[model samples]
Structures are given as C-alpha cells and as structure tokens.
Target chain A: MQQTRSIEMGTGLFVLLGMAALFFLTTQTTGSNSLSGSDTFEVTARFDNVGSLKNRAPVRMSGVTIGRVTSVRFDPDTLVAEVKLEIESQYDRIPEDSDAGILTSGLLGSQYIGLQAGGSDLSLQEGSEIEFTQSAIVIENLISKYLFKQDSGSDEK
Target chain B: MLRELYFSFVDFLRTFGALQLFFLRLLANSPAILVRRFGLVVQQVYNAGALSLVIIMICGFFVGGVLGLQGYANLAKFNAEDSVGTFAAFSLLKELGPVITALLFSGRAGTALASEIGLMKATEQLSAMEMMAVDPLRRILVPRFLGGVISMPLLTAIFSVIGLFGAHLVAVDLLGVDPGAFWQQMRSSLEIGDVWEGIIKSMVFGVVASLLAVWEGYNAIPTAEGVGRATTRTVVITAIAVLILDFMITAIAI
Candidate 1:
C-alpha cells in the first residue's frame, strides 16, 4: 500500500512536469504572440512577388517589430500576392498611406515586411490595405537584368 | 528453398494477423480498464515515465547542446550564427524530440516490459490468471499499453523543452549569439502546426512501441531463451517502425 501511494505520487509529479513543459512550449517558446490575440488589427498588402516571406514573419516599422505577417495568399483576380499583416493595437497610429516593402535581413537571412510610415492624416485601421508596396527583390531577376543591360550595351557599341 | 520461402511467407502473414488481432483486443479492452483499473495504469505510468525521466532529461540536454554547437558552426560560415536557435528548435521539435524519445523508450521501458511479461509467462503466472478467469489481456496488457501511450507525448514535450533550454545555455551563454535574435527567430519561425506535428508523431510512436512490447512478451515461448529473444525483437522492431513511421509522417506533413 505504501509502495502504491509513493508510485502514485511520483506519477502525478511526472505528469505535472510534462504538462508544464508543454504549456511553456505553447505559450513562451512559440511566437503565438500579441498579433495572434484580439489586441491586434489585421491589414492587407498586395505585392507582385512575395518571394519567401512566410507566415509569422515580423512586420517592422523603422526596424522596430510592431506586428507579424499572419497570412500570405495569391490573389488570382488581381494577379498578386496578398500578404496579411496583424499589427499590435498599441501601434494604432501607423499612417494609412505607409508603404510596405519585403526586405531581406543581412545578406542571406530570412525575409520580413518593412513598413515605412508615410505623411498622412489618417491612421491605418482594421481591414485597411496598404496601397504603396515594394515586392521582394529576386536575385535571379536582378542578375538577368544586369546581364541584359550589359548585352544591350555591347550591341550598341 | 522455394518451399521454405513459401512457409516463411505464410508464417509472416500469420504473425501479422495475430498482431492486428492483439491490437484490436487492446482497443476493445481500453475503455473499461481505463475507468475501473486506472490505478493499475498509474502504477505502470510511474514505472515507465518517472523511472525513465532521468535518462531522458540527460540525453535531451546533451543532444540539444550538440545541435546548438553544430548549428552555430554551420550558420557562422554564412554569418548567420543568430539563427542557430531557430535551426535547433526546428530540428528538435519536428524530428529529434519524438524520434529519440521513442528510441530510448523502446530501449528502456520496452525491453523491461517484454522481459517482465515473458518471465511471468515462463513462471505460469499468465496461465494461473487464465485458470482463475482473470483475463490477463485486460488486467495486464491494457494498463501497460495505456500507460505508455499517455506517457509518450508528455515525455516528448519535456524532452523538447529541456532541449531548448540546453540549446539556449550553449548558444546564448557559451557562445556569443545575440540572445534576442536566438529566441526571437525561434519563436517567429515555429508555429502551432509544427508543435502539433511533434505531438501527433509521439503519440503514434507510443502506441506502436507499447503494442509491440506487450505483444512480443505475451506470445513468447515460455522459456528463458524465448524471453531473451522477445526482448531483443521488441527493440529491433520498434526502432525500425519508428524510423519508417517518422518518414511517412514527415512526408505527409510537409
């Protein structure tokens, strides 16, 4: 009987420990953060190319992380990538005319959305779309354009 | 040779059929045992989970440290050492945590279960239970199986959390990686779906490992050599099954 009780106690502790670990992972480790909660407002931005910008990538204003990219989907009718940004409610004063650009970190780091606030009287509200956007810079396209420019220059010579 | 091959194929089919039948019986008996014999399951949980926690934690820490070290070295070449946390977390959560835990579980608890049940069979305890009409499958096997299933995801979760801590210790403290970048990248890159994938994989592995252990032991020839063979087979088969299932699940998930 004593053995069984001890076994039960040990098992209870073990189970609790496991639960605690899982809770930590869910809440702390994974970045299901302020953007995921109701304390954020969602806005959409359209890009000709989104490159490798994935969901949950940071949305930064002047290099300060203010939100997350909640979703990236193709708009077949508009023929562009529609990226959803979930901005924290505290940053509710972002101008409606801000420009959203897909920018890479360092030389070969992950891509993130950069918001350059524009001079506008209105603030970005829920469901408002950022009008001015710069698409992701594809390396291959730049290389091909450079090569094509060189080829045309030689042809002119 | 052809005749021998035919016989072996037939034997394989028979064993597979029996294993399937055993699994069915387990599922059938689970609910009743879970309700009435909950204490038995708890005892088994203690035996399988608590007893094994020390080794699991130690291995988790070392494995995480290795991942951090390796990740740092590789990412440093690209001047992206800060991404080591993301790399380690992804690897640990998606692949290593469940796979390593299951492999270790088979080595530890699976062998113990097989040998113990095989010894009981050898000692005629199972037969005595049958004589007393006490359904050994219900009272013995079901509890053990349930305990293993319940313990596996929990163990995997603990392993991953500890692994993250170990990685943090190595990357942030030992190395000069920016702590903010390390954690921020990991948090942003990982999603609930990735965590769910790990949980699902662990649970599947748990069912397979526990079922294999109990099944091997229950059907072992009631002899010393047979018991040893059953224990050995439990480890070997569980390891192979885990790898194959991991591949399939990963492919489907991705």
Candidate 2:
C-alpha cells in the first residue's frame, strides 16, 4: 500500500512537470499572434518583385517588428505582386504616405518588409495602400547589371 | 539450401503474424485496464517516466549545448551569429527533441519492460497467472503499453524545454549574442506548425516503442537465454523503427 502511494505521488509529479513544459512551449516560443485577434488592422502594398518574401514574414519599422506579411499574391492586371500586411493595433500611427520595401536580414538571411514612415499627419487605416514601395533586390540582376556596366565602361575607354 | 531459405521465410511470416495478433489483443484489452486497473497504469507511468527523467534532462542539455557551439561557429562565418538561437530552437523542436527522446526511451524503459516481462515468463509467473485463469494480457501488458504511450510525449516536451534552456546558456551567456534578438527572432519565426510536428512524432514514437517492448517480452521462449536475447532485440529494433518513422513523418509533415 505504501509503495503504491509513493508511486502515485511520483507519477502525479511527473505528469505535472510534463504539462508545465508543454505550457511553456505553447505560450513562450512560437508566434502567438493568432489571426482571430481583433487587435490588428490589414493594409496592402504592391511590388514589381517580392523575391523570397514569404507569408508571415515580419514587417519592421526601424528594425522593430510591427506586423507580419499575411499574404503575397500576383496581380495579373497590375503585373506586380500584391502583399497584404496585418499590423498590430498599437502601431496604428503609421503615416499614410509611408514606403514599404522588401529587405533581407544580414547578407544572406530571410527577407522581410521594412516600413519607412512618411512625414504626414494622416495615419494608415485598414484597407489603405502604401503608395511608395521598393521590390526585393535580386542578386542575379545586380551581378548582371554590374558586369554589363563594366563592359560598357571598357568599350568607352 | 532452397529448403532452408523457404523455411526461414515461413518463420519470418509466422513471427510477423504473431506480432500483429499480439498488438490487436493489447488494443482489445486496453479499455478494461483503463477503467478497472487504472492504478496499475499509473504505477507503470511512474516506473517509466519519473525514473527516466534525470537522464533525459542531462542528455537534452548536452545536445543543446553542442548545437549552440556548432551553430555559433558556422553562423559566425556568415556574420549571422545572432541567428544561432533561431537555428538551435528549430533543430531541437523539430528533429532532435522527439527523435532523441524516443531513442533514449527505447534504451532506458524499453529494455527494463522487456527484461522484466521476459524474466516473469522464464520463472513461470505468467503461466501461474494463466493457471489461475487471470488473463495476463489484460492484467499485465496493456497497462505498461498505455503508460509508455502516455509518458513519451510528456517526456519529449520536457526534453525540448530543458534543451532550449541549455542553448540559451551557451548562445546568450557565453557567446555574447544579444539576448533580446536571440529570443525575439525565434519567437517571430517559429510557427505553431513546427511544434505540432514534434508533438505528433513523439506520440507516434511512444506507441511504437511501447508496443515493441511488450511484444518482445510476452513472446520470449521462457528461458534465461531467451529473456536476454529479447531485451537486446527490444533496443535494436526500437532504435531502427524510431529512425525510419522519424524520416517518414518528417517527409509527410514538411
């Protein structure tokens, strides 16, 4: 009887420890910005090329994430990529004329949207589109352009 | 030679058939054990889970530390040392946590369960119960199997948590990476899907490891040598099964 009682106590503690670990993982580690949260507003931007920008990529202002790219889709009519962003409600003061640029982290890291706020009193609201946008810099394009410019310069010389 | 080969193939099929029948019997008997002999299951859980916690925690810490050291070295070449946290967290949560925990569990608890039941068979304790008309399958095997399945995912979860802590100790404390970026990048980049993949893998591994251990023991030849062989086979087969299953699950989940 005593042995069984101790076993029960040990089992209960082990189970509790496992539960606590799981709770920490779910609450602490992953992106908990559930889509169902009403504390965010969505906006759109268009780019000539999105490069490697993926859905859920961070939207940063001055290196601090304010939202995430919710979707990236091609617009056949515009011949561009339309990006949907969901910004936290707390960061609703972003100016209406801000610029959205797809930028990479470090030299070879994943790409995210970098937002440069404009000098305007009007704030961006739900469904508003940012007017000025920069597409991701394709490395191949840069290399080819550099080579072509050098060839032209050499020919002139 | 052909006759011998044919006999071996038939033996393999017979063993496979028996294993399938054994699993079905265990599943059939599980409900009764859950309701009536629940305390037995709890006792097995204590035996399998609490007893193995210390070793699992220690191994998790070391594996995480190694990952941090290696990740820092490789990422620093690219001037991306700051992303080591994200790297370590992904590897640990997605692959190492469930796979390594299952491997260790197979070695630790699987061997114990196999040998214990095999020795019982060797000593005729199982036969004694059979003579008394108590179904040993219901009275013995189902509780242990259930306990293992219940304990495995919990153990994997604890292992991952401790592992992340170990990585923090190395990456942030020793390596001088910014603490805020270390956690922030990991939080923002890690989706719920990666965590779910680990959970699902651990749950599946738990069932496979437990079932293999019990089946090996139950069918031992009721001798000392046979019991020893069963224990060895339990560890060997469980390790191979866990790796193959890990690859299959990762391919599907990814």
Best by DockQ: 1
lDDT tens digits, residue span B93-205, model 1: 99999999999999989999999999999999999999999999998999999989988989999999999989989989999899999998888778888888998999999
Model 1 clash pairs? none
| Model 2 ranges off by over 4 Å | A32-38, A119-123, A154-157, B1-7
Each prediction's fraction of true contacts recovered: 0.84, 0.78
What residue pairs are clashing in model 2?
A: none
DockQ of structure 1: 0.75
lDDT of 1 at A101: 95
* Candidate 1 ranges with C-alpha deviation above 4 Å: A147-157
Q: Write the per-residue lDDT of candidate 2 for residues A10-93, one digit (tens) a residue.
A: 999999999999987876888645543658899999999999999999899999878889999999999899999999998989
lDDT by residue (tens digit), candidate 2, B1-254: 99999999999999989888888988888888999999989989998899999999999999999888998999999888888888988999889999999999989999999999999999988899999999888888999999999999999999999999898899889998888988987886788888889999999999999999999999887888999999999999999999999999999987
Error of 2 at A121 (Å): 5.8
